[model samples]
Target: MSPKKATEAPLTRYRQTFSGKGSFGEYLDVSRRFGKDKEWGVRINTELLNGNTAINSNDMEAQGIFANIDHRDKKSNTNLLVGYRHLNIEGGARWFSLKAAAIGKEITKVPSAPEASKNYGFDGLAKESEGYIIALNHEQKMNADWKWFLNAGMNSNKLQRNIIGASSNFVIINDKGDVSNNLMSTQTVTKNYYAQLGINGNIKTGAVNHDVTLALDKAWHSIEGAKNMYNNGSMGSVSGNIYSGLQGNNVWYPSIETGLSSKDQYWGISLADTVKYKKAQLLLGVHKHNASVDSYNKITGRVTQTVGSDALCPTYGFVYQPDEHTSLYASHSENFDKGTIVASKYANAGEVLNPAKTKQNEIGFKYANAGFLTSLGIFNIKQANNIDVYKGSDMYLQQDGEQEYQGIELSVNGKLADKWNFMGGLMYLDATQNKTQNGTNDGKTVNGAAKWNAVAVLEYNPDEKFSIVGRAMYTGKADIYNEQLQTPSYMTYDLGVNYKTAFNKTPVTLTAMCYNLTDKNYWTAYGNNLILSSPRTLMLSATFDI
Candidate 1:
């Protein structure tokens, strides 16, 4: 008889997200080999997110699960996969505002409003959602050096809100300190669906190779809501007049009797080729995209037709190696963003708009020696036909514009000693606009583009049973739109330690980790004065493998 074949067991792993708020969650992932070929496998993963903000009494929770099966030939000539995923999110708030003006009512200053707090109430909001998705993919080798692949997928999502109780009662006071006790409750729901299909292939010939891909997608969405107030004792009465624009008794009345629906179709195709000879390689590609949108009125429920412009893009790159330990590369690419249906619905009587475009270029070098790898790169990017939100107005403006961004980045990773390893990167950017609405070139910078950014990591393993790791990141000052505000960048650090051992001959591991050690105050994004940043937090986890 033949010798007995070896069997491979499944593998499992776990991870957790650390938050400053007392909110914590974890994920479990497992993968297993299938059949004697060892080229087929299956994987499953589950994750959860939960946390509470100081503004709300109830905590928020989100959960997601996914599973996939993949199979491939031993020669990697054919491959197949199937996948499914589900996600659920639920949370509650003291109050939820649907419109931006409602948000302006709670905060004294318009621009100073904390974006996060406004999502629910002065300090309360609640929301929940569930999403489901399925996918199938296949790849086959037609020749010794040619392959074809195709994928199709679909997704469905539903969202709902729950309002049950209030922990505190508060009054909205004007500049004159006039107070009004108005308590209200409301709920809303929304649903969305999406589907997509795509195919790609590649071929090789002598010293040249060619690759191409195409894809198409479609999506649909809808929303509905109702509210009830405590003081009015009526289901659809207006509570009080906050903004001087509408006539109603209570705030729970049906205000927006409107519904919106849209149908979108998109097609994209790209062709890329590479030529290799000696110590150098050259790559070039061209891509084209076309899309159209049709919107249906919620009240009339009639489809309105709109057409989008076709976009053409081109890209090129070169790579050269002068020695075994050093290499250099450079690339240039163009990108475009299509105008949306909203612009067609709300544009001036005869206004017409075009898609925005961006051109980017970069050059870089890489060196590896003595178990250390280092890289340096420089990039320049410019954008035209840009879109901007009009200052002090709720309208958008499109202009023949130009903005430039120049940046340099450097990174290194290596082992310094028998027990230590480190990796770090630093980047500096100089960005400004060459043209705006003012006719003249203003040196104003774009928001969210920081001038300096850096990340550092260190790891130490003294023995096979114990290890420690630390990481830190820093972001420099960035510009903010509106009021010409400036947001100060901040630094965050994380550290973790792990211990492993055998229990009853079963492998076990324990880890303790801390994030945002300094609890530095910073804004997550620009334009929203949301003092929202990950706070300092600690997490402890245990795992077992059998």
Candidate 2:
């Protein structure tokens, strides 16, 4: 059987190949205020959501609870806050092919299309995750010219997934959807902790007034898991037609084992100062960052690779407030952090690369008033790139070149009239990959980066009891492949309404929204994969206060 060359032709439409059984979500919140001046308060929030995803053969459930307490004392000029959150989730998993062909269109060229199913996925698959986070904030005034603050947080999460059998990345073969299945399961736990302390002081250098800040910060992160990575090569075959519905069977397969993986933490210290002279303000700062990473062999549980880096980064900016309603600004910044971990399929699998550095610069202006506000900006960013390089028979994942992104953005927001208000923004972007191997893709546009995008929203409030809103969003053409093909531009619209009233003297609010009002069919680009856009949806909600 020969593979169909359907994707070679321009993709005109994205066929919808996913369906969901149903979905539901709900939330509750409560708050209280106590203290002589009502400067102390506490709040609690809870949310739950469960549903079968639109993606065929996938379902998800999630729940979370959060609480926070805050306090302020005018006598000491101090404030404190503490918060905690817990969340859990369960879901199925799937992946997409790199081909740009429309979904369900691949199997149509085959002779056995009727019996073949366009939908492909796993049956004995399960994914579960749980996470917790705690945070603290404190601020105090040491004197009229100086103040201090502290911020701290910790987060932990665990994930357990059982892939009953592995499948191909959803591809069409000989007009049929074919996949190689294998058993795999893994459990991973990750933890992150961070803290920061800073002090702010007001000083005068001759005629210039300055606000200076000095800060120190540290962080720790680690990952541990059982059978962190696993692959059972070709345990079985799960094949079907791409044009028809392919239901997965509840067949359990044997499990396999791999190695462990971990990422160490990083720390940073910085100082910043803002100098105000006349109508101009200049900002300057520098940061020292250090980080490390480690990877281990899955089967041996032994360290296979380690990498670390230390660097000094800088930040600079200037703002000129010409008038009360208008201002201009420009800024530059740099960052460094741990690099990518090569995937198991790559020649450099389990290898940790050195830290990557990124730099950015921007210039912008803003005009503001009571009834309206608008801003325009241009920005440029450059970062090291990690790409898959074909070498002989095996693909090697390595750091190769630099990817640059340059863009211009304009936004407008605020009231347009006595009963009308509007908000919108437009952006034009040019992103390219440079300095690849042999310059093969030196000037190609980065995948999934749209050249132009815009959004506009209008709202009307005729009275205190009701409000209406309308919105429009547009995305221009984007590169879907390695500069070989592109996805066409698309637009979507939305409409919504809000009603506020008193129910038995209790304040109540109700909202209804219709998304993708026209039910337009479109395609979304995720990296190199082409995905069908979501269909029209309606949502309704109510809130009550007593």
Q: Which ten residues in a row have the lowest lDDT in candidate 1?
A: 163-172
TM-score of 1: 0.74
Candidate 1 residues 98-118, lDDT tens each?
122323364333222232322
Please provide TM-scores, in order, for all candidate models, with all chains considered together.
0.74, 0.83
Steric collisions counted per model: 14, 8
Which whole-number lDDT from 0 to 100 does residue 457 have in model 2? 99
lDDT tens digits, residue span 1-546, model 2? 111112222222211111234656666666666767767666666666666554444556767776666677742333333333433323333343332342235433212212111224555456667787777777888988898988888888776554433321333333344533334455567788989999999999898998999999988876665553443443333445344433344344445343356667788889999999999999999999887777876667777777888899999999999999999999999988676776554556667765778999999999999978999999999988676554542346677677899999999999998999999999999999988778877988887889999999999999989999999999998874466556678899999999988779767778788778887766566655445555566666767765
Alpha carbon deviation, residue 418, candidate 2 (Å)? 2.8
Error of 1 at 489 (Å): 2.8
Candidate 2 residue runs with Cα over 4 Å from true position: 1-22, 52-58, 75-95, 99-122, 162-185, 225-228, 232-243, 249-260, 343-349, 388-397
